[model samples]
Target: MWYRISSSTVIWVANREIPINSTSGVLKLTTSGTLNIFRNTSDLTPIWSSNASFSVQNPVAELRENGNFVIREENDDNPVSFFWQSFDHPTDTLFSGMKLGKNFVTGQEWYLSCWKNSDDPAQGEYTYRLDPTGYPHNVIMKGQNLTFQTGAWNGVRFSGRPKSSGNTMYTHKVVINKEEVYYMFEQINSSVSRLMINQSGKGQRWTWLQQAQKWSILYEVPSDNCDNYNICGAYGDCNINNGPVCGCLEKFVPIDVDAWTKGDWGSGCTRKKPLDCQKGDGFRKYSHIKEPDTLSTWIDERINLKECKKSCLRNCSCMAYASLNISKGETGCLQWFGDLKDIREVSEGGADLFIRVAFSDSDREKNKATFIISLSVVGGVCLLGLPLAFCIWKIIKKKSKLKRSKGILQGSPKGILRGSSKEHSNMSQKEDPDLPYFSLTTLLHATNNFANSNKIGQGGFGPVFKGILEDGQQVAVKCLSETSTQGTNEFMNEVKFIAKLQHRNLVRLLGYCTDEENKMLIYEYMPNKSLDWHIFNEFRNKLLDWPKRFHIIDGIARGLLYLHQDSRLRIVHRDLKASNILLDVKMDAKISDFGTARSFRENETTASTNQLAGTFGYMPPEYALDGILSVKSDVFSFGVLALETVCGKRNREFIHSDHLQHLSGHAWRLHREGRTLELVHQNISQESDYALEMIRTIHIALLCVQQSREERPDMATVVLMLGSNGELPMPSQPGFFTEGNIVGSDADDNTLLEGR
Candidate 1:
């Protein structure tokens, strides 16, 4: 039988299948506390009954405001412990506060099944609920076949939905606890809105407008053909605005071109060349794109943006990555390790997606350097004749001057020693008089009059500039800034230290210029600048892959080893940080800036100074607090730098929750907790042994930063630790333990030493 509720609406019933049938279907309470619904006429059989497993003196049944029929004892006031309710056995519509997901632990599912037809209330073809498998997300299935899906829930919002802003009518959340993974939405105004899964297999939001006395459509999903489940296929982007509306990404073509031309894009696209597991595949970043489907992929929420790229880059199977929620300033990362599907293009609110491409495409895009160099060589040959006459004239003048000076000082070895011996009694007896000296004018011209634009960077004693010599070779000229507090003492220190040192890892001091009010030291230009540049910038840091970073770490270790042991003069670099480690174009690491370097006497083991000088956070506890200096001080700074490189965060400003302090301190705590792997940056490939090596590096760093100077490792041991997998001693608590103050406050507020 079917009862008409309205002209277009009917409540269907099978005579015997559903025993309950009547307009006045009355369910009465008995003294035994059981309520039974009976037919109004004697010939009518009893319909449905509420046989609640509870006893009470009196019971009552009533219809609720939300259309739920319930029975409860007369004296019982706690509504939560309902005896029987129609909501537990729901019909078609899912109201607010109703769960629509599985409880895996309990084997219970609260899902919505579409009605069979417009007039029938039977179960139909579609079912919608949350899927808890593989990074839980909401999914819709049409009779056991997956049709539509909402991407995984990031910390802030659903990955599939464009982040919402400026509206507060409804608040939605997806919760995943130990017990269950479910999705729910709550309305700001109780009487305002409702969500429904209609018979057409559509999920929609409607707002009740009291003024209009009708439901106003707020939003609806599956908005168009592009929104259809996996309509564009794998690695294909669907855009309604495009002429074809569906096409593969760059470097990719349709798997079935004929099907694609016929507007049947379900076949998707494929890469022209298959990825070689060992090589020949790289990622290309596509900005402002909807990420492809990630059904069976692993995701690391804690990984930073750089690590996300590296993680995908290292694995040949990994295809792409995007910010889990783009609006959160790209905090979380999602990686697709297999085939990607259901990608689309939106005019706004899409994330940047990086797609893997064959190596050939990467080579073509990266060939600009060769082309530019070729043109430069060709141009240089053409201009060779133009400057030949001028070069000859200058060379002749220089030679003439040199000849005149040579005769005047041909045998004046004693005179040269006399002038130099007066300045330094400890000078080597065999000094070379031919050491080159640049005129002040020549230095000034090379640096473009010391314009700020030419200045590449600044250090403790001065500003370094990018300079081009008359011969067209680039040089880095370190000029003492007039306002520097170190003055001529520090300048002379750098010249004296660097002039005597010759090592591959040490920076080369090409020459120096001395004139009234001008003192400058020139070195070969480091085109890649400093290690800090790449290690600090989020996007640029991605360029420093694990192998490159590992190489840099080893290079720094070897340089320090040479300074402390192999060099004729034992030197201590008082200040060592990422800023001091320079990189050449090939990414080879070079140590630079010796303004504060000190040389120890042959037998002296340590030195003391009343003045403290070095960058904060990288300073050794003893050197920063007391007036002591030693090779151990440099070791401490090196340890801090190592941790910073691995963690990709500054030690001084590292923050983690409410309990961890600086990066060093937090890393130590994690080490103690047996969770040091948590310290590794997410982008690092686990397949590589970087995690195990980084943990070892962290322990070694901690050993170097120990509170007691004697407890720290020397440069030799540090080098060995970095180069080999030797057994290491467990480190004690590092210096400056402040895990109690995880949320770092102003260091100045405390009576700590101000300078290091």
Candidate 2:
């Protein structure tokens, strides 16, 4: 076994199966182009051999970076030269870049066999491999008895494991040629990944986190009940979200609805009416469905979906048909004959399947489709009219808004104002020397001229769109909206401030775009969008479990602490809310939208001004009413954001069952009543272990949003309280707990878009 510094754990084991009681084993390459593993015993017999008979001039054996031990010619005469390689005979671990399939000509099969036990090197009963007996699909077996199967690849990804398609850490590829068929994944960056089949028969992907100095689970197989083969029986779609987890396809009925309702779903569905092979017999297309089992299916590589459908129609035995790969155009055909077994309906996996149905059912479906098309025509007309009317109204609004914007520009701007647009652009380049300058042409092409399809959301300053650079790097482009009240000052404030700051929890400013007509900033794109994107929605909130929510709270606290003390200069994020918190692929929260942020010197603890800015619900009483600003103002906002994350509801949008108090007041009441856990997001509070952690979070939130600035803890103290298990001070009444008492409660927060 070989070890490395990043991790002391065993990375590679040479002589896995053969054990020597005394002298152990020695792995060496022979004089010939062959590698062997031999146990150092009195008998002196080689236990494992590369078995390479091919001869090469000046042959040498070496191990490559990808953990491939190969014996090949020394020179570059033959680049593809490989007499033998250890990758051909993998033990249990499947490292990234290693192929997991078979070579037809060589008759060599590549698969991952589970280790017998933690201490044993023998292969176990479970085997995870690509089965090419039929249409290719990754499968798991318990000594030849199939347990789980990832539905065959449909061009983009496996029908069952759709998430394998768009993983950020790695990209998976499959190749089928005249000689070989294999599946391999390559890491996008220099990240170490390992796929191991455990002794229990489960396969999991682990990715090394350089910062955390540990590995995280990227994915796993057989994750749920639906993953089990034939769980829902034949001709039934399994949906884990469903209570029964199984349901009959359209135009079909349960074999025994009584048994099905009683949780005995072994007997799957049957057609209500048999297909008569009549001229009107047609297929019903089901979208977002996991294609049926492919063990007994027929596939044609040359034909398209249309050709496949024709073929299925001609063969009366064909039960269902679907396109093999819909990643691009419809290419290849897969037809399932007889009964469709192990079918599934997933939220976001697989392609559409067209199943055969009786003529009567087809006619009814046609009639329904006709009615829907007619209704859609009416709806389409209304939609077109609404957009036209909205555009006209928007034009008028834009003109009036333009007049107001010009009116503000007529006078010289005061404090916290940039000298001018020209100075704002020049000074940022001078001050933020490390910041990249993206040309307008480059940005325009990257964002498709700010196409609506690419637009992710709107901020106070402009529209934020997701863009891809020429290098395939995805970024969020924040272009200044023509009607935006935020101009030179706020723009420069963010560019200069965030450009100087560096932290994982702080949104990184990749670059900026400046021109006569455009003022734009480029940032690392957040795939999961803002915190408000999830918490404000009932269904999406489920994605944020208590652990994830707590993680975000902790991250936000650390980010705030960095801004207050750790950074080169003390910074205050004036606009901190759910909408301002962006989540990365790992669900790590990053504080974004720093256009309204302020900076304080080392000795400055507080600052006061007549200019009051920030969202209503998040602003503290002192900051909103008295125009006093400090680290506490940001702390108050953090408190509100934390409450929103835990409650799974917006601060201002909170609707109480008992009374009409805001979210903060609701939390205070719950705390006083010894029911602080009740205020937690319903989706997360189900776990008893995390109940205490959640209650403590709510307590910290209350302490941060205290009515008086003096009572609120500093960002450092808040971070300590969140990290340690130490007792916290009792929280007083939080500001803005009541709607009427909130300053600018009814006014638009967009007014704060412009700094004083």
| Estimated TM-score for each candidate | 0.44, 0.55
Off by over 4 Å in 2: 1-11, 19-24, 38-43, 51-59, 73-77, 118-121, 163-169, 188-192, 209-214, 278-280, 363-756
Best by lDDT: 2
Model 1 agreement with the true structure over 1-756: per-residue lDDT tens digits: 111222332222212234443475554666665655566645344565555677766666665555445677767778655676655554445555556677768786777666676445567777777787766776677788777776556666655555464557777777767787778776676555655555555665666656534454454455444556787888888764354568887778999998889988888899887777585566677754555656777777788778888888887778877666544677667778777888776433456677777766654455766788889977876778757757877998887566433321222111111011123312321242334567655766787766665777776555777788897667888766544545556766777788888886888888876543356688988756788877776755644555566667767877988888889889999878888899764456798878778999878878888776667777777777676888888888888888877767788878888565678888888999998878766666452535677778788888888878899989988877876678999888888877442223322111123343
Candidate 1 at 502: error in angstroms?
74
Predicted candidate 2 versus true structure: per-residue lDDT over 254-277, tens digit per residue: 898899888777799988887789
Task: Output the lDDT of residue 658, model 2.
Answer: 82
**lDDT score, candidate 2:** 0.77
